[model samples]
Target: MENAKSMEYWLQESALICEFMVFGALAAAIFVAVKFERFWSRGRGKREDYVYDNVLWRPCWRALHPAGLMAYRAIVFLFMAVVLAFDLHNGGIHIYYFYTEWTFTLVIIYFGLATLISAKGCRQLAKNDSIRNQDVRANFLKTDLEQEAHVTESPGKNLDGDSVKLQSHQEREEQKKRAGFWGYAMQIIFQTCAGAVMMTDIVFWFIIVPFLTNEHFRLNPLMGSMHSVNALFLVIDAALNSMSFPWFRGAYFVLWTALYVVFQWILHACGLTWWPYPFLELSTPWAPLWYFGLAIVCLVCYTIFTFLIKAKEKNFPKWFPYAYQRLH
Candidate 1:
């Protein structure tokens, strides 16, 4: 009895420590964000102007300077390396005693492949940005030369021909639309994968496993390991989602998460019977309160993360595109 009580005490203490660490990290993130934002809003210096006339090299320089682009790439690579190393160290192959080993292996492989593919795509995007910038500069120069020639032909004539000006404006509008569309698509893809991962882990851990096992069934060692891995993935997803915001503007992700939580809560409240997950059966006196508190904490963490990314962009003006300059 004494040993059992001691073990329970240690678990409670560990839980409390974990909670403190999470909240502390969130607080620090928020503090950093606020300080950075204040510093930027003060306008300490003028933004460095990049001459767009250099057709070949200007894009390359600009692409390299963006706030989170390079940092994100480095972070993802390092994270993947660490995960791969850990997996190798654990064994050539680790199996879950409870869940199917195939399922566990599939998830790891899927994410690993995804990280590799995304890294390649980001490099390509950087290259494409450079090429696109060169094209735009070349076109602008050609347009200027044509306008000057027309004016020189009739010295008294205005250089701004209505037809030419209208055409140029239309072209600019089209470019803007294209960029926006691409940004939206990227955000959708990123958020969908993130949400899927989260929902899958939640259901797999809290619902499926519990429902499948009897009370006497021992908790799967693999399930705990998987949960830890998923948590780390969540952190990565959060960081990436934050970075992807520079390219896209949408509320769909937030809406989807909210709707998902609501659906889960409603199902639980209806007593439809899901699993042994704490949230599903709030027979514990403080379970509902604890869950609601956790939701609020998540919201605050998200807000802080968003602010930090935005603040970083503000501090480094060159990191963002012209379209974002005004907003920042």
Candidate 2:
């Protein structure tokens, strides 16, 4: 019996390590493909209908350009729904409803918010460049031409064209809408959610599920896929969405985990003796140290994602399908 248990433990460990490698390779391939823009131009012999962006994984994203953001969000929203529903079905509403589950729910909400924004802005996004160019032409060149023909300059006087330039400038300024409160809220929420997704899942696979899950616990496919599924979906959305993730946003990530810790403590106080995660339990003498260590781990996870965004901006052009442009 002891040997059987040992062998089962090793089998689970091996499978988890394999999953880690597979997901790592997929992420690396995506990072490289997007950085080099390898598939942006062509895929072969005069076939314009060929696979463009994400050629290695075709049909994941489409060719509709601006609408791609909406598509990506939609897919993420659906996958998160499945994960959430499956989790709720598995455990109902117990105290063991873990932090990963909450974070996953947060991600679903963020994706829903993103999809709403994308749907609202799609038409304007599609037409922005052409409309701006036309406005420039009308304000600078065509208007100046008309002024030249109709209102001729005096002998030693000249038309400065300042009014036309100012009008064009004002039009451009009007297009620059400030990202008001909700926009900024969504930004922080999304970045924090991304970091939480990675951290919570990593802990689940390596620490909780393997060594800590009860001996008689029977795992379903959805339970097995939870950790990788969270990270994979977020990475896909990261690859296909244009969002600016600043370094300071890591503060929000810290706040999110703090909230989860507080919630767990509350649950413990309210007659729940068991913790969803062993390291999170406050019954030990090392509880404070465990909390501190977990906080540090969360920060590291957040920093890793911040660096991922930095890599995207540094390696690729601003105009790449979906990436933030660095300020000059």
Candidate 3:
């Protein structure tokens, strides 16, 4: 009976593998077909000094009003946190032992960081307000003022009220420049978290959950939706934020997966009895094939998201009358 059950389990796993492989290959083909040249070349193919473009979009992403963006971040942060709490409640804190939970948690941290940074950037301004240009100009002004200070050769130049006010402005500008560290950190975190979120959630929903039905692992409705919810939260965040999804940062996605795989291997070396997903088990002779297949899936996942964001930029103006046209 034990041997018969083992045979049945392997049969079910085989069926799941075939189903996911066929579907994934077809979907990847369709996704790549949207912009064939980009995939062939791994990018838009313009040579540049940086691996990724400095400006995510042409006119700059900061054009989006910070107040709206802040509110969006807060909402996303709250929603994901609540869902995460619910998931933990259902499965116990041991849930974090899984990559899906950890990746989703990383996204929550991304939003938490985003909310705080946006609030700082907004500076009690209204929804339509953004000080991006003002801040940039202030930095330039501060630089000029410092240069002038070094060049001042007069023994004592008597300053008027205007000079005092200008000096005060320069001081504030320097402070503003110092506060910009969070904003830069926010950009890198956002880019890395976006790809990681998509990869984790997509694989769970499309591939892992389906096979787990027959295994000891079982996905309830909420668990099933967790993947989709994670994706939805990040996609909405991207749409509303002033950030662009740069394709070259796909390196981050690769790094994120490598870290997870390494973690699993470590667990296995320490005598863990099983793998989280069937394909991840390195004990089999076909382990390399499974690894290569999953790598292809990861590329496809990133490509699909890249297309989605670019499509939003390309089509938003056509669909929405006023605000969409002003997004960038």
Best by lDDT: 3
RMSD of 1: 14.0
User: Whole-model lDDT, candidate 1?
Assistant: 0.41
lDDT of 3 by residue, 1-328 (tens): 1121233433455434543554455455445433422323353443321222112221223456556666777887898889899988877976765788878888888889877766655553332123444544565566567558877633223223335555567435533332244554555566666777778877777777665545646867777777777788778776765355556556556666666766665665555666677677644556557776888877888887889878887787677646653322
Q: Kindly list the per-residue Cα lDDT of model 2 for residues 1-328, writing each as its tens digit.
A: 1121233422454333433433444455354433432134232322212222211111222344546767877787987787688778867876145786788788888888777766656655446556655665555665556667868634212223544555566445533443444555566567788789889777777667777777434456776677677777777676655565655456566656766665764565455555677676543456556666666677688887878766766665635555333221
Off-target runs (Cα >4 Å) in candidate 1 are: 1-175, 179-182, 188-253, 262-277, 318-328
**Total clashing pairs for each candidate:** 1, 0, 0
Q: Show the colliding residue pairs in model 3.
A: none
The Cα error of candidate 2 at residue 21, in Å, is: 34
C-alpha TM-scores of all predictions: 0.35, 0.64, 0.63
Q: What's model 3's lDDT at 115?
A: 76
TM-score of 1: 0.35
Error of 3 at 11 (Å): 28
Q: Which of the two candidates, 1 or 3, achieves a greater TM-score against the reference?
A: 3
| Candidate 2, pairs of clashing residues | none
lDDT, residue 176, candidate 3: 35
Best by TM-score: 2
